[model samples]
Each structure stands twice: as structure tokens, then as C-alpha cells.
Target chain A: MATTMITTLDRSSRAAARGLSDISIRNLFIIPTILFLIVFNIFPLIYSLGYSFTDFRASTSAAANFVGLQNYRDLLSDPYVWSNFAITAKYVIISVAGQLLVGFGVAMLLNRDIPLKGLLTTLLLLPMMLSMAVVGLFWKLLYDPSFGIINYALGLGTFEWLSNPKMALYAVALTDIWMWSPFVMLLSLAGLSAVPKHLYEAAAIDRAGPFYTFFRITLPLVAPILMIAVIFRTMEAFKTFDLAYILTSQPTAELISIRLYKMAFQEWQTGRSCALAYIVLIMVLAITNIYVKYLNKVKER
Target chain B: MRKTMTSLLAGIGLVLACGTSVYAQEKELTIFWAEWDPANYLQELGNEYEKETGVKITVETTPWPDFQTKAFTEFNAHGDAYDMVVGDSQWLGAGSTGGHYVDLTDFFNKHKVGEVMAPATVKYYAEYPGGSSKYWAIPLEGDAVGWSYRKDWFEDPKEKEAFKAKYGYDLDVPKDWKALRDIAEFFHRPDQKKYGIAIYTDNSYDAMAMGFENALFSFGGELGDYKTYKVDGFINSDKAIAALDAYKELYKFTPPGWAKSFFVEDNQAITENLAAMSMNYFAFFPSLINEASNPNAKNTGFFANPPGPNGDQFAALGGQGISIVSYSQKQEEATKFLEWFIKDETQKKWAALGGYTCSAAVLKSPEFQNATPYNKAFYETMFKVKDFWAVPEYAELLQQLNQRIYPYMIGGEGTAKETLDALAADWNATFKKYGRGQ
Candidate 1:
């Protein structure tokens, strides 16, 4: 009786209210968001797109002149820029592969009924929650050649991790993996939980081996979410800057993002940095297209 | 009618100037500087300034690693966040050309800054184009590359005999680069875990470049002509190659895994008893001199950059000049602060408070020279300082040098001649891109 009275009163109130119609109210909510995006995001995108065609120095108040693809041409032909791209690719592959293996392996262990499961999972996830810069600093101390715990613990005896040009990139990728693996683990865990118990019971009754059951049932079921996690991680790993920057200064660890940062901010080559950014963006989009196709295949299965 | 119009315009101009001066008397003023001991001392001076004047003065600082980035970000945005910046000498080119700093040519002459400060300091730190009347900054912190050594080991009779027997020299402070190398080799005993000198090898920013500049200047090599910005043949000259070879030779005797060591690591090598000698800035020598901060303080001795083969000595200029930001609204008040700051009495107090003052009056005083073990060396270094290009494109030049020089210097990526050739080409291309090269 009370609900009916409230519904009756709300209908009467709406009829009496003339401040805004439903369409107007909807627009009121949506228009500000559209305006905000246009002002903050779209405007910068358009502005930078224009700048990418010019010779602009942000540090100076001089007028920019249009160079008409000169920045792009120069970057495309630059050997050091190519080297940076190659370094970035190596870092992504190493970091993403490591993250997937470690994350899925841990998730497999946690999928089973375990003691203090929540606490164990929380502790494992701690590294992912910490600031990347902070983690890099701690790792630097750990990797120090003299009196570092890693050298002492493993008897590597003063192995240079960050300073060694041959090992610096891999060392940085390893730190990236250590920090991000738990993200993949969490996604994998969710997928594992969602796998129906009846399907496992069905496989057990059929006398399917553990490997067979996992391959036929678990693997196919979790593939979509696994692909999603991979897509997210690969994109982020491609643009990794903080870990690589803070952990090492070796040329081997100079990823493209770091180059972009140096160009845009340090070198103050605003126009060229914008052009190079567009190049990275195009590459990211191409990779995303390939990932999306794979995701579609997983969905079809 | 013409006189009436001129008088009317003059009256308006005078009123606008008065209006700006009135606006400049703001309640507070802020300075941007790197978070170092000098900045702290500057803050103490700021406190004194606050007491003298009604306006509050705040010294905002960032760590050395990100100081340039922070300053440039603010400058790029044309922000009025800082009234003054105690910025690196190299930044004058960018700061002046970009209009980040107010041109102080007239003010400099009016205040007679060049007449009172060290001539080299005025050349490297204040004047953007060496020997020019144009000025954008005041030589504030006068610094140069200096060294500290293990004095206890040097004084050991057995070590002295062994050094004299092996290298035909006494185990004392080296007077030249050749003797320095000899001393380094004498102490480079790997099995005993004691290494040679520690120097800048960190690839980031200007560490390695600054380290190499010591050798470069000593051997009488130049990167290029600063005026013309021409770098093709000069950087690849025989003398430059030899200087680079000398630096790499010195690197061979350093402690293992020092491919990325900088001042902090150099200091650690001395305090941790791992190195016999170390090169660092005079700004950082106080830590090694403080017996509480450094365990090896009592056994440490300081020296300036030694002479080269021809008895020519020059150290990389590693100091900052204070400049007023063009965007700042408190220019009048900032000018007042700087005017008071450069006074003889003020600079004396600055030195007393551990702020490195470039004032000729203070540095020449016997009392100031004897105040610290490194003071005399610092005084000597001030006269023989040289700086890199202070062009607006210096970041590009410095970064390129760092990227090319590091792998070769630390890792032996290529021959010195080849490395220098590659750098010369890189620099030539860079200069052309900036439209400075012929």
C-alpha cells in the first residue's frame, strides 16, 4: 500500500515538474561528458596532429613552421630510432611471455582448494600494487654489484645487472614481469572460478586424464579472458617507460617510449616527438587489430 | 603638437613602469633550484633576506635527476611559478633563447657583476655568448671538478717504497694526469679487493661527458668552436682521440661493475674503502670531509684536476647561475633580492654558510681559503674552468654525446677514433638541423 502511494505521488510529481523533460535530462547528463572529452582528449589529439606536420619547439615562444612530413621521414630513416623500436619489441616479448607463464602457473596452483588461499593470493598480488618507480629502486639496490642480496644470495659475485649492456634490457623486463604477473594471475583466477563444476564431473566420469580434461575443458573455457589479459598487457608492455627508465640507463634498455620522452621533453623537439608518437600509435593499432582477430577466433571456439 | 604627443606618451610609459613596480612588490617570492647542500644554504640566506625585507622567500628544490625536466616543464608552460632559478650554466642558451629568463644585460652592467666576480665564472656562468655584453644570469655557485684520495695509504712507508720501486714515483698526490694514472695503477689490486680511482661513468645526463671533459680540456682538445658551432673535424682530431684514450685507460683501473657509477658511487668507493682516489664535484667534497658522514674522512685529501702533458689544466665547469624567470610577476622584487645577494658582505656570509660564492672578494681571502681542506683547490679551479656549449640546442648535443660516448668509454664499443668520428658526424647533423652549422 505504501509503495503504491509513492508510485502515485512520483507520477503526480513528474507531471507537475516542468524544469526538464526526460530527453532534456538525458542530454544534460551526456552533453557535459561529450564536452569534457572534446576539450581534454579530442582537442589535444587534433592539436598534436597539426603539430606533427611542423617544426615546433615548445621551450621557445617562436612561431612553428610546417615541414610537411619531414619529421616522419627523418624518424623513419634514423638508425637510432630503429634501434629503439627493436629494443622495445624485445622488452615486450620478454616481459609479456614471462608474465603469462608465471601468472598462469600461479593461477593453476590457486585454482584448487588451498589453506589460507585469500591471504596467499593477496601477498602474491602485493608487488603489482606497489609503485613501479619504487619497485625499480628496490630492485636496483638488490642488483647492486657490491654487497647486494642477489649477488650474495646466488653467489653471482659482483655481476653487473643494470650496467651491463648485454643484460640491462632483460633485467628491466624481468623487473616488469615481477611487478605485473599478479594482474594476469587475477584474471586467470576469475576465469578458472567461472568454469562449471558439472563439466569437470562429466570429464571425470568419462575417465579422461588430468591433461586431457585441462586441454579439452579448462583451456578452451578460459581462452577468451586469457586473450583479453594478453591484449591489455601487451599494449602496456609495449609502452613501458618507468621501469626501464628508473632501473637502467644502458642503451640496450632505451625503449621507444623513453626516446619519445627524451625527444618531446628533454630535446624539446615538440613537432618531431608528435610525429614519432603518431608512428607508435599506428603500430599499436596494427598490433591491436591482430590481437582482436585472435580474440574473435577464441570467441568463435 | 608633436611635443604634446611625445609628452603624453612619455607620461603613459612612466605610469606603466610605476604600475609594474607596484605589482612586483608581491608578498612572497620563490626560487627553483636542485635539492643540494647549496640549496639548503641558499634557503638559509633566503631566511636572512626575509628578515631584512618584509616579503617571504622560499627556495623550491627538486632532485638533481629531474631538476632540468621540472624547470623546463615550468618554462614551457610559461608558468609564473618561480621568480628565480639557480640553473646550470649550460641552460643559459635555452633559457635565454626560449625567453624563459629575463635578459639582464643592462642590469648586469649597472650592478658591476662582472667586475666583482671571477672572470671565468662571468664567462661560463653569466654570459650566454662568451665575452658578450649580453647577460641572462649571475654567477652564483662557482664549482669545478675536484678529487679526494686515500691519504692514509699514500703515507704508508711500505706502499711508498713499493710505488717508487715499481713506478719510479713517490706515493703522494698526483700533479698530472700521467702521475694520476700511475697512482691509480699502483693501488689497483683486484685480489686484495682495493681498486683505483672512482670517476663518473653514469651514462645519464652529463656524468660521463663531464668526466671526459676533464681529460679533453687537459689534453688541449675542444669539442668544437662554440661561436660557429662547427664540430666536424675538431672533435675527431688526434688530440681528442688521445684524450678519450686516456680517459678509457683510467677507466680500466676502476672497481668492477662501475660502468654506471656517478658522484654518489665515487663517494661510496672512498667511504667503503674500495678505492684509492675518486673524482667528483667540489660541491660533494664536504660529505667526504665530514668525519661523521664519511668513515674515511680523516684519511682523505683533496686536489683540483691535475695538469695535462703540456702542463695545461682545465676542469669542466660544473656550477649554476641564478636567473630571473621572464614569466615571474615579481621581477622588481627578484631584482632587489639579487642585488642584495651579490654584495660583498652578502657573498661573504654565503660562503660562511657553506654556499659556494663566486665573489672575488670572498674567494681571495686567506680566511676563506683555509676554512676547508678543499677551499684552496676550489679557488685554484675557479681560474681554470671551461664549459660546454651553452647553446639552446645543448640538450640535444649533450644527450647525443652521452649516448655515443658511454658505450665506447665504458664498454669499449669502438675505437676512440671511430667513436669520435661517429660523434662528430652526429653533432654535425644536429647542428645542421638546428640551422647552426655551416
Candidate 2:
């Protein structure tokens, strides 16, 4: 009876294989996904690209005219657009630097044998998990001059964290770092835990100084993953909007995304905003490519 | 196989029947407006309408900052999503020019809407320009930037004596900008955690425009040559500089974070007794009156904006009008609802229900005049209103003011004169973009 059942199952399997070719089965599985991508993603991307070359106001019913690079030229020459780019660059640098420092520092500290390690790591990662809008609102309350607990704890005499333009951008950067450093921390923690214990042992036998051991062994081992984390964070920081928009109203804190929003929605300059968005995308892609190349080089070494 | 096919066909038939029945059961009409206290009243009224007509009315609201963008996005897509919209007065130009709103000229004539509401309301809120005959909306809510002060503090004997000794004048509602400044200086008690006034300076939203425009207007500063859209001399005039200087000077007496203050923060200051006075919308006065715990509830005093050196007093118009979206599928139902909403009886109920209806019958009623402590002030300020340009490019122009004036006044970045000069240049460029430049 067992032999008969086995022979029947093998016969069905052979029949199924003959019914559907491997290539046809593969195509059947992937066609829906490919169609979805074309309909939702590629269509809008190409449609918006076409609009970027026109004089189109999204809020109006007037027909779009092919202005042939006017929108791009205007954006490139606009001082206000340049100012927004400058602000975004400054914010990206400050926020990413702060995240890398705090994240790497915490990861190194946690690399040792510690009590309540899992619970502590989970609590530290909470900020990164919360919604950005919720985090923005929470930080706004914390930065309030009259009622915030931060001011009370610091005993600073009425510091306007999100009000003063001089301090507003930095205040927003601080919020970003607080929320996202845990992301870097998680990634670094993974890389740190994966490093071979034998390498550290070898360094110890050589009587390498702490800094030398870190710079030579641990860092090289972690560089590729660290570069990956940096690249991810750099792209996110450059597109930062919610925290900056919700926390501070100061022009000094306006990022490229916020400026793009104002141009697209507020001013109804649809074509110009599309052009601005594409410019930002290209810049981010270039930066990411550079980081990726370095990351590949690090992996090779 | 036959039974399975029959069941599948039955399921499809059931779904179609249910869909058709659901569609026919209720006629839905949606009204889009900003999220505010009045939305609850509108929802209540919508519920009442449903009870009377068997038509469901849905009131959808977005935050004030997002309302314009959301409405425009919906309208620009030419979707029959919204039956009616309560949009900002500045939206009139864009809505009319872009054909987003139904041209209410014929409806206005048929209903005599111009004769029903106050002339100023009809002209400013309904018409594209001040006196344009083409009506695009019906005035639903009347509002303007007005002043409110702590009457108890001003009337306190010790405080009054101190104010008199310091300013050489009695502590009273300021009639002019100078008196207002002096009052602010007198009551300024930052050491005791008390601020003189709470004024909005945030670059984020319309706070800066609402808070500063009145002062600029009072000082005889014109935003532009309204007819020609010329902005150079008017926005950067010496008088404008003086007005901005006076406006910024009050920052010394405001709270530490007042530079980023909007309506919520300003109201918080007044209710918390952190600030002795507040500049806010009259539409918000009812909320102030309802704050039982706040000293302002019992001792609030309202005043129209103080006059300038030239004795010119003006209030920045802060209100919205209701209009029919051109693309609404339920246009007839929405129009019926509007007809009911603007009726004399309904208008009275609208005011009583916490909506600031602009119906002349309601405004002239004794009940409406004495409805709240600030009601009379609301009436007075509505008549003295000055509005910004109601053009398609209003947002761009307003942004220029926010970017320049906010940095100078709130961030302490540049001189008032320098800020206004830069703003003038920017406005000129913006006007030129729209083909309105001189």
C-alpha cells in the first residue's frame, strides 16, 4: 500500500510539471508585481518628469504649456531655493554626524556583558519606532519655553528652543538625532555582535593600545556596515520634513522638502516643484552612490 | 460544478443588489472646512438638516494650514468629492479664476443675497474684489483681528496707580498704537512670570500676517497699489518701517517664546494669565468667554485695533465664506442646504450655535449683540476691516511678508527698514511673475 501511494504522488508531480513550464510558472508569479510597479510607481515618476518641463499650475484648470527647461532654470537661479538647499545641507550634516556619534557610542558601550541588556536595548530603540509626526509633537512640547520639562530640568532661564532662528535649526537637528540615533545604534549593534572574538584576543596579545585596537581592528570590521548606516541616514536626513515643520516655524529651519512642499502646494507651482524634487533626488543619488562605492571598497579590504 | 457556478452568480447578484440599495438609501453631501470649534456646530446643523430632508450631510475638516492645499488639490483633480467648501476669503480669486467654485452671480441675484448680508461682508468675502458684482460665495462667518485685555488687571487699584505714575495716563483700553505700547510697557512683569501682551510672530502659518498687517495698515502702509499690483513704495514706505518698528518693540514685553507663537500659544498665554493682553481673532472670543477657569472669562475687555500716528485704524480681515464646488455631483442638494443655512431664522440659530454668521439680521439683533462679552467688539471690528490682496498670487505675497518680517521681528535678524526693503523687492519680483508688476 505504501509503494502504491508513493508511485501515485510521483505520477501527479510529473503531470503538474508537464502541465506548466517552469518559465510560465515564474512569469505567472511575477507578472502581478511587475504590473503593480509599472502602474503605481513608474507611471507617476514618468508623468511628473513630463510636468517638470511644462508651465503647469496644479491648482488651475488651464492647459499646461511646454516651457522647455524654464522651470529648472528658474529654480536654479532662485535665491530662495538656494537658501533652502543650504539649510538642508547644514541640517543633514549636523543630524547625521550627531546620529553616528551617539549611535556608535551606545553600541560600543552595549557590546560588553551588561545586566538587563535586552530590556535596555529595547527601551533605547523606542524613539526610532514611534511615528515621526508624534515625535515632532512630543519634542515641541518638550521644547516649550514656559512649560517644558527640559527647561525645568536644565534650569535654564527661559530658553526659546524652537522660537529663536539662531537656535531653531539646531533644536530641530537635536530632535532628529534623538529619534534616529537608535536606528544607527541597532545597525551598529548588529555589526559589533558579528565581529569575531578572536580578533580582539589577537589585539590584546599584541598589547595594542585601546585606541589603536579600535582604529585598526574593530573599525575596519565595522566600516562597511557603518557606511551602510551612514548612507541610509544621510538620505533620510536630507528629506527631513515632519520634525522640522512641526517643531519650528522659522525659515532658518526650512529643509528642502518643506521648501518643495511650499512651492508645490502653497504656491501651486507644480512644474517648478517637480523640477526641484528631481534635483534633490539626483543630488541624494549621487551622494548615496559615493557612499556605496566606499562601502564596497571597505568590504573588499 | 453546476451548483458551484450557480452559487458564484448568486453572490454577484447579491452584491449588486446591496450596492444599489445602499446607494439609493441616502443622498450624501459633503462640506469641507478647516478644523475649529465651529465645526461641531456645523455638524450639529448638518444632523438637523439630515433629520428634516433625509439627506446625509458630512462635514469634513482639515487643519487651517492644510485646508487651502487640500481643497485646491481636491478641486484641481475635478472630483465630485465636496459639495460645499468654507474657504478663506483670499481663496476667492483663485477659486473664481480657476473655475473651482460655482459662479453665484445668478444665485445671488435670484436670492438677493447682497441685500441680506452686511455690505462689507458681501463685498469683501463674496465678491472677488471689494466691489466686483460677480459673487462667488456667501458670507458665512464674519471675523477680524481684535484686541482683548485683562480688565481685572487694568482696573486693579494698585496696578492702575502704578500705571498712572509710570505712563502719566490712566490705565484704559488703548485708542492708539502709542497708548498700546505704553500699556504694554507698564504691565510688563517678566520677573513675576507675567507678560504684557501675547502677539503672534511665527513664520509657519498666517499668524504673522494676522498679527502685523493691522499695525502696518494703521500706519498708512499699503500692501500694494491694489489696482496695479505695484508694491515697491507702499510696502517699504517710511510709515511702514515705523509701524514695523513699533510692532517689533512689543517683543520685549512678550513671553520668551512668543516669537514662535500662533493662535494656540497666544490664547494659552491669556488663559494661563501669563500675558495681560492678547491680539486674536474675534471668532475665538467665544472660546475665551467659555474658559471658566481663566480670569479672562469674567474680566475680559475687547477693543478694535489701536489707531496709528495718522489716526488711521484698521483690522486685518479674518474670515471665510461658503461656496458650492463646481464639480459636486450633489449640487442641487448642496444648494438647498445653503438656502436653508442663509435663511434669517437659520442665521439666528447659526449665531446662537457658536457660528459667527454674517447675516445682517443676526448682527443687528439685540440677542446677537449681547451674546458674549466680546460680541459688541466683534461687530465694531467687522466694519473697520482691511483685507490683503485676494489674487491668485496672494499666498506667494503673504509668504514674502512672513519670511522677511518674521526674521526681523521674531528672530532679531535685521533692521525693520532693511526687512521691509527686502520684502518690497521680493514682492515686486512675485508681482512681475504674475504679470502684475509695474
Tens digit of lDDT per residue, candidate 1, span B49-100?
9998877889999999899989999999998989999999989889998999
User: Which pairs clash inside model 2?
Assistant: none
**Model 2 per-residue lDDT tens digits across residues B195-304:** 88888787765778877888898998877777777777888999889989989988888987876777777778778988778888887777777757465687777888
What DockQ, on C-alphas, does every prediction get?
A: 0.58, 0.70
Residue range A29-143, candidate 1, lDDT tens digits = 7999999999999999989999999999998888999999999999999999999999999988999999999998899999999999999999999999999889999999888
**What TM-score, computed on C-alpha atoms, does each candidate reach?**
0.93, 0.95
Off by over 4 Å in 2: A1-18, B1-22, B292-296
Off by over 4 Å in 1: A1-21, B1-25
Error of 1 at A37 (Å): 2.3
